[model samples]
Target: MDTKPIAYTMSEKENPAITVHVVKKSVTPNVPSGNDSSNVTPTTPVAPTPSTPTGETIKQPAKPTIPNYAAKKGAAVYATRALYLYKNENFKNSQRLVKYPKAKRVNRPMFVVTDYARSTNGVLHYKVRDVNHGSKTAGKVGYITADSKFVVPVYYQSMPKNKKIIIINKKGVNAYKDANLTKRVKNYKKGTRLTVKKIVKHNLASRYQLSNGDYMTANKKLIVQGDYQIINY
Candidate 1:
């Protein structure tokens, strides 16, 4: 029983075996060059076109036209109401030459129209030479209103069909034997009727030739075309 102990040795073919694992890797494809139609790229967005402006342009008003019935050149006119003489047709206050007060019908201030003009406001004006005898403003030239209410033609401008005229001036008018009115013949009282032969023009003023060969002023303020019942003034 003492001889049972014995030595033992292991061989290489009797050892346990070990196992190992291996991993696989992936590869990517290269891009084509030089204007390839198959290749795509990012694009930028486009903006919309703008519309044209539609604002309207403002315009100024047209000037007024002159009337056919307006007073003519080389005619006589007289003021019926107070008025101002202007240096220019603009009729501005700064352009005023003088202020004339309203006068009596028989002694109203008179003027001889030299030209016609229109103010900026479209009002018509008469360019005239003052002919008020003995007035300090006589012979002065200026512009005045052409309104019928403020100014009017001194003469009727046409012969009456009856060929008769009557004195209407309160102070009456003088009859002159000469056209220049230098020689005084007589002074006819108001409401006196006289037959007219014809009309005569002297120094841009009109005179009526009487059948008696005497001359009287044809001023509308002093004479009327038709005869009426005489009334004592």
Candidate 2:
């Protein structure tokens, strides 16, 4: 399911890498609905009250009101890699600027091109890596969207290629096969999208990271591929 992640900025020194920032935090109110719980003192279970006429003691009744909104306790933290932004890109916070230097779409200088591909209608796709949003100088991670009329201006002159992400653990592979592992969904660092190229059949176990520092094969199948850009920056 497509979910909206909390957006924030990182320091300028954190580009092309995993960056995290604290967003908004809220607290839930604890208005008591039952007997006097809010004002209840641990020393005494029954609340004390003043004496009424004829020396009769009167206990105060609990007051109930609208409770404050709070997210459920123990909420999970959502994090993801930062991505590029473009003008009118249908992203959450899309903006336009015409000053960014135009770089024609090609294999990114950082990530090596691999054999994986995807296509939409007739246009091909490729995976983009080390994407940044806003100014890389700002060191902020954000989201933006772009259309075919891209801001960075990616020309489909040649077929695109790039590396893909994978979870690298033999136990993770075995757990994935048995459905015993939990989910690992993360936000796309906002405004992240990729272009499509032809896909290679299998991952070939080329990239693997060890959980206990032991390497595992990465035979994961290819699903999608594309270069990423902010449209018409």
Candidate 3:
């Protein structure tokens, strides 16, 4: 377990600044020849117009954050100063880049984001345009579906990827179901955890597939599935 407490040091000090004053005075020079010397006794210095200070206050901006999910080498990735990655057509071996990169690449590569994983401080990332690395922008996209209606359609570890998958949450609620949807089959336990892997929406009453294709009813009362974490033994 990477359970290390991130420590920080705090220090306080008075801010430093520069102070300046503009001295202004109205003095009548010796008008008469050698007669104003004794008469021109210096009066108390008058303070210039007392007013509020106004000008630009220069402040440094905070640095940009780098995400944790780095683009796979040769695999198209977003090349950001805050989120930069390597570029290569033939993606073969792996390598690592250090912070404040000494060598900089003038070329930029488009990136596709990986799902479910988090980067560094956990900033949500997205596909960097072209999903391919070899494409024009060196961005490449995955396979496309045949029937694209302008724009159409849109797991859990430990368990088999197949098994007619039904995703459940910490609450034992199945958000998805993948069971054979036919006529409603009954004579099962009441208030059991379930997944709706398969639902024949065409019919008024659909079948709700359970974790392993076992099921109940879509019209019946069932607990709603929500966010959950699986505790392994």
Candidate 4:
């Protein structure tokens, strides 16, 4: 056991270096859970309804009918009360041509109808000529109301039960031997009273057979049935 120090040494073949390799992993985003209410599906929309109308409807008035006994064209008409003659059927105050006053039956103002017209309000009117002899308004043409209360036929159409008839025409009527009124035999003055036996028809007109077998025109403008008292207004 001798006391001595010694050094050690190693070759490249006996020592080797070690090498390390690093690998990385990718990260993913967070997602909602299946139990969350934010994952619900959308619903469809609805449409609104329309409103109804509530107003009332209006109607127009109907026209009135004329009476069969009413005076017609070419007939004489006289006013029972004061009446105004109008330039047109409208009968406005501004269109008034003259005012006719009611008078005694024998001298009452008269008019001869030429035609008929209806107002916008369905009132009836007569187109006529003022035929009162010697009147300042004579021969004037105009329109007047056809209201029976204000105006009426100058003569009567129906026969009276007593068979009495009077001449009403301003001019006298003539008696004939035949119903045709061809042979004029005698003339009866206005206001003359006569009795009729019967009525005869010829040429679309009527004639009255006198008690003496004479025939006279039964024209409504010429004669009236019954005895009427003299009236003054």
Question: What are the per-model C-alpha RMSD values against the true structure?
Answer: 21.6, 38.9, 30.5, 19.5
Clash pairs (backbone) in predicted model 1 = none
Model 3 agreement with the true structure over 54-164: per-residue lDDT tens digits: 885767985544333333223223232433232221222242121122212222233344322223544333322344334453433321111112111111112222323
Comparing 2 and 4 on TM-score, the stronger one: 4
State TM-scores per candidate: 0.57, 0.17, 0.17, 0.57
Provide backbone clash counts, one per model.
0, 28, 12, 0
The list of candidate 3 runs beyond 4 A from truth reads: 1-186, 220-223, 227-233
User: Candidate 2: lDDT of 45?
Assistant: 67
- Tens digits of per-residue lDDT, candidate 4, 1-233, equal 32343434434665764343333445566677767769756678766676555685565785556667557778778887899999999989899999988765666678888888889988888899999889899999999998989888764445679998888766878999988887889999888899998887564356789999999887555677776652221
lDDT of 2 at 205: 16
For each candidate in the order shown, give its overall lDDT on alpha carbons: 0.82, 0.29, 0.33, 0.78
Give me the runs in candidate 1 sitting further than 4 Å from their true place: 1-67, 160-163, 168-172, 176-185, 200-204, 229-233
Output the lDDT of residue 73, model 1: 81
Candidate 4, backbone clash total:
0
User: What lDDT, from 0 to 1, does candidate 2 have?
Assistant: 0.29
Give per-residue CA lDDT, model 2, range 70-120, as digits (tens). 111121111122234323223323342222343322221111111122222
List model 1 lDDT by residue over 14-86, tens digit each.
6755333333344557787757767867579788888656796566886655576666788888888999999
Please report how far candidate 3 places residue 81 from its true position, in Å.
Answer: 54
